[model samples]
Target: MLSLLDVFTPAAPVWSVDDLIRYSGSPPSTCYRYLKVLCGAGFLARVANGSYVLGPRILELDRTIRLCDPVYVAGTSIAQHLTDSLGYSTLLCILFSDSVMCVQQARSRDAPPQLFNRGQRRPLIAGASAKAILAHLPLHQLRSIYAKNRKDIASGGLGSDWEHFKRALKQIRSDGYCMTVGEYNPGVMSIATGLFNRDGEVLGSLAMVAWAENSDITAFRTLTPEVVRAGQEISARIAATENMMDLPARAIG
Candidate 1:
């Protein structure tokens, strides 16, 4: 039944009962019964044209998560502080399932239109924000991801083969951060470092972004330490808080 909600997305936010039935491959009677339960429970709402959209309960849940999730609370303050001090946009992104999702963003005055804004997910291949977390993932998980995306990994220039890919990520892991220019977003430079939990598991990445024209390549490298520091501070904050593991991050919308 919950799978029905997966059909609603930014590109197609409304679905009729007929559409749901066809998409779910469920009989009309089963679809109607599930929709009735979902609508009654406020997981979905019927529209004027008999289509349905996500209901207010989802908004309530989102609000609750932003307010109560330890990672979000800590990352929000850290992201805002970095943006204020660095004069660059700051993003806090998490590893949501296999994708990277931005959960918090603090934008500077000259910041470009965000390629992936808060609550939006992006692929795990091209950007510093994604690579920082990718480099820290457990090797078995990394191997699985690489096996599934060999072509994309090669296209992103990480490597053409699994061993090469592992070596590339190993280098980034040793460096403790990833820096990229115009790889994810044209004309933008991003430096990212991993955020970790109490158990030393990677939670996400903290990235600072600026226009390429505004930053000198050599000088930009200087800010890498600052971004790394912010990432560590956020990780420390997560560690200091009790029961953080119980509060798994809800980063995707």
Candidate 2:
């Protein structure tokens, strides 16, 4: 199921039979069978271009998960409130395998048309949201990711070498947040911080973004702490909920 599901991700949202076989490594005959069955089941749709994409059934499943996702449950209200108060766009993101995917966003009515990206995954080596989470990841996992994506990592300015890359992450870890101007989207700047659960496991990242031209150094100085505070608050709530879930039934009573 997951292998089939992976073919419709942010990078390859549409796929042909051959594309699926290449990515999924399933035999052509087996891939053909599943694609036909999936389209028939409404789990995928045969698009006009003869490629397959996720279908209505997948949307239904996504909605169900969103309604239950702790990140969405704990984040939207705060994200919306932050957007309203700060006059910027706020977003929640989580690790989707080797990258980070946007899960939720709230745009201030006063802000310019916000970046219309929700569900798009970005390389974890690039943006403030990804960096914040990347800084908190286990060192081994971070190194593993870097080893495979070194070219992207170097080009994106995390570092050109291992020592430089480690230093960059270490600085972010020490700062407890990441701030970048025009790194991902030119003319857009962002501040991000990590979220953690009860076991101190990295949950995701929370970020606020605004136009860089109008936002000077002073604006960054003002917004960074606010975004970081919101991230910490969300992490606390997630941790508290996790702890509650871990409690014995009799303990609750």
Clashes of each: 0, 0
Candidate 2, number of clashes: 0
lDDT of 1 by residue, 115-146 (tens): 46888888888899999988888877887788
Q: How well is each residue in 1-253 modelled by candidate 2, as lDDT tens digits?
A: 4568765666778888777888777788888888888878889888888888888998897897587666766788888888988888899987767778788999755443546367788877888898988887777787788888899889788999889999999999999898877777777778899877677777678998877666675656687888988988887787767423321011000
TM-score of each: 0.93, 0.82
Error of 1 at 90 (Å): 0.3
Give the RMSD in angstroms, all C-alphas superposed, for model 2.
6.0
Indicate which candidate wins on TM-score: 1
- For candidate 2, the TM-score is 0.82
RMSD of each: 2.6, 6.0
